[model samples]
Target: MSSSSLQLPVIQNWSCHNCGGCCREHLIEITEEEKRRIDKQGWTAADGIATERPIIQKIGKGRYRLSHQNDGACVFLDDSGLCRIHAKFGEPAKPLACRVYPYAYHPTGEKSLAVSLRFSCPSVVQNLGSAVTDQRIELQKLGNQIVAGKKRDHSAPLIHRNSVHGPQQVNWPDFHRFLKAFDVAFADTSVDFVVRLMRVLSWLELVEQSQFQTIKGDKLNEFLELVTNASVKAQPDNDLPLHRPGRLAKVMFRLLTAQHARHDTEADVRSGLSMRLNLLSAALKYTTGFGTVPVLHGSQSAATAFEDSANTSPEQHRARFAELEGEFNCRTAGIDELFTRYFRVKIQGIHFCGPANFNTTLVEGFHGLALMYPIVLWLARLRAVRNNRSTVSLVDVQTALATADHNFAYSPALGLKSALQRVSLLAKMKQLTSLIGWYSR
Candidate 1:
C-alpha cells in the first residue's frame, strides 16, 4: 500500500525548458470551472491574450478546448515561446493537463497509481531532470487526488487470455509478482530486444494457455523460469529477421507511416498528399522485395533468399547485432526507467492493467490512459523509420511521444480498442527493431 513498495524510480526534479512544443503540439481541454477561472483572469487585446475570439473555444456541444493563435500555437503562448498564463500568474494558473506535461497517471489496482512520462517532450527524451524519486510528495498529492475514493476491482480479470487460478482470488501482491517477472525479463542485458520481447510474448502466451486454477505459487514461479530459459535459448542466430513485408503488410506499413508526415494546416493535408504518396511508394518498393527482387530471382535464388541481407558474414552479423544492442541499450534505458516508475506508481496507487483497461470498474470513469505507452513507442518507431536514421534521436522520440499522446489523450472519437490493436500490430511486426534498422541505414 506504500508508494515506495511499487519500486518506482525516484523523480528528482524537472523544470520545463519552455520549448513551447507541448503548447503547439497539443489541444488542451478544460473543465467548466477552469473556463470560469481563466475568464476571471480578464484578458483584453492589450493584455496580450487574444480577445477577438476568446482563447477558449467550445469543441462541441458542451466540451471546450484552448484555442490556438493564427499560427496554430496555444493562445496563451507568447512570441518568445513562453506561456502567457505562466508568465503572468505562475505555473499553477495553467490547466492540470498543461501543468502535468511528460507525467502521465494510470490506474494500477484498488488503491494505487502508475506514473509514466509523455516522452513527447524533448526534455524527457534527453533524460533531463532530477531522479523522479525526488518529486514524491508532489506526485503523491496528484496520485491521491486521482485515485480518491476509488475501490479495488478485484473481480476484474488479468489481461492475459487465460483465466488465472485461485478461487480465493489474486490480489495486487500476486499481480506484482507477475510484473516483477516481466521487468526482469526486459532487463536481461545479455539478450537482444527481440529476444527479450519474444521471451515476454512467449511467457504471456503460456500465461494465457494455463488455467489460473492450475497455477499455484511455486508453479507460477516455475512457469516463469521455464519461459525465461526458453526465450534465452530461442535467441536468433542473428538479430530477428527483418523480412521484406508481404503485400498487405507493406500497404499497412505505408498507411501507418504516412500518418506521421507533418501537416501544418488543413490545406497542407491535400497539398502534401502527393509528396506523402511518393514517400509511401518509395518505402513500399524497398520493403516489399522490389529492392531485393533481382537477387531473390537470380541464379543463387534459394541461397540468396535465405541469406541475411543485413549482413554478409558471421562477423558482420555479430557486428550489426552489437550495434543494434547498443542502439536498443541507449533507447530503452530511459524508457525502462520511465516504465518501471510508471508501473510502480500505478501499482502503489492501484491504477494499472485492469478495469482501467476496460470499463468494468465503477467510480474511476472511463479514461483510456493505459494505451499511452504503446502508442508513444509506436510513433517514436515511425519517426525513426521516416528519418531513415539508424538510432532514434531523443528529439524525434519526443515528437512521436507528443504526437501520439496528444492524439489519444484528447480525442474522444477514437476508441480504446482501435488504439490497442494498432499497438499490437506494431509490436508483432517488431516495428521498433525495423525502425532502428531503417534509421540506421
Candidate 2:
C-alpha cells in the first residue's frame, strides 16, 4: 500500500506493558500454519513452562485455539506475566495475533486498511509508552500481511441508509466529516450525554429514512446541522417518561451478560451465571420501575406526591452530582478516552460502518456501525454498575467489543430490523451524551 493510500489516523506512541490480561482473557484462535510453527519450536516441560495439556487445543471440529492453563492463564504465560514462547525462543515466534497486541486492522477500502486499538489494556487507556504514529512501519508491515493477496470486493451494499454509491464508491473524507460531527456532538457540554446520544440517533434515523443517493453536499450538511441542533435542544425534562423495560431490552441485556460470563477456568465460570443473573435482576429492577414502585402499583400513585412538594435546593442536587462524579472518575476516564479514540479512529477509516457492518454497502452499514458505539457503551456502563466498579474494566470492554464484532461478523440474522431497533432506542434515550457522561465521570 502506498503511504498516500494509508488514510488511518496517525498512531500516538503505544507499547504493551505485558499485563497478561489478553493472554488470560482471550481464547486465542490460531490458523493451521501457526499451529505448525509452534510445534516446530520444540517446547517441553523442561523449558520451565507448564506443558501438562500442551499449549494448543482443538476448539470446534476443525478450528484450533491456544489453550489456557488449569489456572486460566494462557498456557504460555508464566508467573511474572511473561510469555513462555517469547522467553523460550523470541518475540518473532509469537503468533501474529500475539504480536499485534492492542492494534487491530480492518480493510477500509479495496486497497486500504484502518487500524483500531483495544483500550482494555491499562497502558492503552493511560496513553503510556511511545506514540502510536511511531509504530507506523510495524503496523504497515502487519497490514500488508493481512491484506496481501486478499481481494476485497467493496461493492457491498450500505447498512441502514438508502445510499446508491455502494460501499466502494463512498468517499472516505466525507465519512470523516460525519465522524467529526459525531465527536463534536458528544463533546457538547450543555446537555447530558444521554441527550446528546439521543440527538445523534435521531439524526441517524433521518438519514436512514432519506435516500442517500439524493443526499449531496448542501443537503447532507443541512441534515447533519439540523440533527446537531435538535440533539442540543431535545433535553429530557424532570417529567421524562420512565416506562417499564421492554422484553427485548431484557433479552439483549441477558444475552450480553451471558457473553461476558465465559471464562477460561472453573472458578470464573462458576461465578459467571450468578453474576449475570444478578445483573439481569438489577437491570430489570432499575429500568422497569420495579424497585422504585410499590407491589400495590395503583396505591403508589400518590406516593411520589412529595416529589413536587419537596423543597430540596439546587445546591443539594449539585452536591450529589459532584459526589457521583468523583466516585466514578477513574471508571469514566478509562471508558471515555478509550471509546472516544475508538469511535474517531473507526469513523476516520470508515470501518465502523460500511463493509465492516457485515458484507454491506457503506451508508446503511455506517448507520448500523454508528449505533453500535452507543450500544456497547451502554452495555459496558451496565457491566461497570454490576461489578460495583466506577469505570468499565478492560475485560468488560473487550467482551462487549468481541460480542458486538462477533455478531456483525457471523450473524446473518442481524438485518435492517435489528439495526433500526438499536438506532431507535439510542435516539430516544439520547445515549451518546450518556456515554460521554459515563466516560467523564
Cα error of candidate 1 at position 168, Å: 15
Those runs of model 1 whose alpha carbons end farther than 4 Å from true positions after fitting are: 1-7, 10-14, 148-157, 162-170, 216-218, 236-244, 259-441
Q: Report the alpha-carbon TM-score of model 2 versus the true structure.
A: 0.65
- Per-candidate TM-score against the hidden true structure: 0.66, 0.65
Model 1 scores a C-alpha lDDT of 0.49
lDDT of 1 at 13: 39
What lDDT score is found at residue 135 in candidate 1? 79
What is the TM-score (0 to 1) of candidate 1? 0.66
Worst 10 residues of 2 by lDDT: 293-302
Q: Report the lDDT tens digits of candidate 1 across residue range 204-252.
A: 5555455545565777678778877776677643265444334454444
lDDT of 2 by residue, 82-184 (tens): 8988987898788888887667676645566777665444555455688777777888887776676666764323434333432233344445456667767
